[model samples]
Target: MKYEFIKSHEYLFPIEKMCKVLKVGCSSYFKWKSRPISKQLLLKEKIKQEIISIYFASKQRYGSPRITFELNVLGYKISRITVAKYMKEFGLRSKLSKKFKVTTNSKHSYLVVENVLDRNFEAKEPSKVWVSDITYIHTKEGFLYLTTIIDLYDRKIIGWSLNNGMSTKETSIAAWKMAVRNRKFDKGLIFHSDRGVQYANRKFAKMVESYGVIRSMSRKGNCWDNAVAESFFKSLKTELIYGNKLIKKEKMELVYVFKRKWTFS
Candidate 1:
């Protein structure tokens, strides 16, 4: 190690002086520098390059384990620990997902329904239970609000809408309309959401009631009651919105593209 260190600094300092200062002999330093790179060292360099390539290809979202798996799939036999060591040597790290904030506006005169969903996130059939939530995305223009409706049976985002404002007509209602148009539901289908004003407002209530669907709301200040919707938002932020900047127009386009991808796949 001392000879290697002296060799690395030989260009900046006299080789003999560096070897003496580093407590390594000049002969040893020269010998080490003249020696051919070992096969293990060459392989380590190759693995480091592959790890960097895979890390950026995944948008820095893959840590050592996933990168190791991908490397193995690409015919490179490697271990997670070795990958982590190389990543540390190169100061490479996966981008961590940012925490998303809850956007429920429960302070309103609108009626708040009971917590009928009650943490029951499973549905036996399609459209039996639907969960919805609104979350805000930061854009250069301003904040864009996204409303999403998920079918609990398949955990698929059935409908979604993105707009500059969180108005009922533009946000929740638009998403609800899209979901209704896309899927046929039975009479006893449950629509669950946080007690946000948009969901609890009379207009939204009337809209759902007209379809003979039962309304279920989370208890006051309780986000876990609407865990499915919250989980969806967390995924959306982590996978799509985190560490990226988009204007309102671009954000809308992204939302449309994502919805299409989800719808088809």
Candidate 2:
């Protein structure tokens, strides 16, 4: 209870000092500390381990609130504050959100397609409606550009390509190849995307003609016109990109690793 003892073993001695200050004995304090760790402690450790595993496994996308909720679902009794402390100790952190600017250059004279989608995301058949979009990923090397085409009906990512240069060939070829691999050519099937140069280029237009598919583009400077593709990108950033906790050299490096991984769960 003396200041000398308080400074000797600061953390461990504090509890005993507190008990003594409250008129409790060292024998009772020892008894309490000596008692077997509760099942709750064991459970908390388990939850902590699982949380660390999930947090790192997800490349650091999860933070305390999400990790706490996950532990609760796994039958662990713990608070968010506890998870936050454990995360802090382990150097676990959530991903930093960066600003995303729209890179669509619709100022050119290229003809844009009509909005055939009309915000109808549903598809009766697999290849009936395909939505595509492009986004930029940051890296220490440089900006890495990405294009993805999705099957609206099955919610499957059918086609994707990554490149340093954002070109029409980069996107169209990726989408065309994916669509070709999946189903027979269906004339009048809609291929929707924003009115980026890649989608509106004459070469891309010709490629769409070669496939007998109709090209539909979002209106200029309109976010809602290509809502499906926009929403897909948003979810991708939210769940996979922005939510990650890892501080890698570049976003593309992590993205490349993630793309190759298959999450069965």
Candidate 3:
């Protein structure tokens, strides 16, 4: 290991000095350097490059397990332990998830329905149950409010809208329209959200009622009723928006594109 270290840094420091500092003999270091690189060493180098590629491709959101799965999919025959070791050696780590602040304001006089879905996040078929929520992204100009409707069956973002304000029209209604356009609304389909004013407002409720959809609101002051939506926001903030300045719509658009690719790929 000392000789390998000396060889790796030889271009930056004198070999004799490194050998002296590491308490190794110059002759042994030279002899070790003259030997051909072993097959294991060559394989490790190749795996290192591949790990870096996969890490960046995931935007640094993939840890050892996912990276190991990707490597196996590519016929690399690598294990999670090896991937984790390499990641540790290279100081590569997945982005840590931060706690996201809830943006729901359930104090309105608007009517709210009981939790008919009742924390049953599972959906038997596509369009059977949908979850919606709003989150904000900070930019130089101001905050950009994002509203998303996800199909619970597949956990896909069926529709979304981005705006500078969190009004009912801009938030819930817009996202609902997009979701309606994208998927067939089954009769008695359940649309779930927190008792935020956007989702509780009579206008939005009537709009959803027009499509024969059942309205379900989270219990007052509780987020777990709509946990799926909150989890999606956490992933978005951790993987895309946290610790980054998104000043332009183009960047947000690019993020959306990457999100779709990551979700489907």
Per-residue alpha-carbon lDDT of model 1 for 83-191, expressed as tens digits?
A: 9999998888877656455567888899988888889998989989999999888766667788999999999888888887888998889999889888898899999
For residue 90, what is the lDDT in candidate 1?
A: 84
lDDT of each: 0.82, 0.73, 0.84
lDDT of 3 by residue, 9-96 (tens): 9789998898889899999988888899999989889989999999988788877987898888988888899999999999999886
Which residue pairs in candidate 1 collide? none
Model 3 ranges off by over 4 Å: 1-50, 63-89, 96-102, 220-224, 243-246, 249-265
**What are the runs in model 1 whose C-alpha is more than 4 Å off?**
1-55, 62-102, 246-248
Residue 209 Cα positional deviation in candidate 1, in Å, after optimal superposition? 1.3
- List the candidates' TM-scores in order: 0.67, 0.61, 0.68
Ten-residue segment with the worst summed lDDT in candidate 3? 256-265
Model 1 has how many clashing residue pairs?
0
Give me the displacement of residue 26 in model 2, in angstroms.
Answer: 27
Candidates 1 and 2 compared by lDDT, better number: 1
The whole-model C-alpha lDDT of candidate 1 against the native structure comes to 0.82
Which run of 10 residues does model 1 get worst, by summed lDDT? 256-265
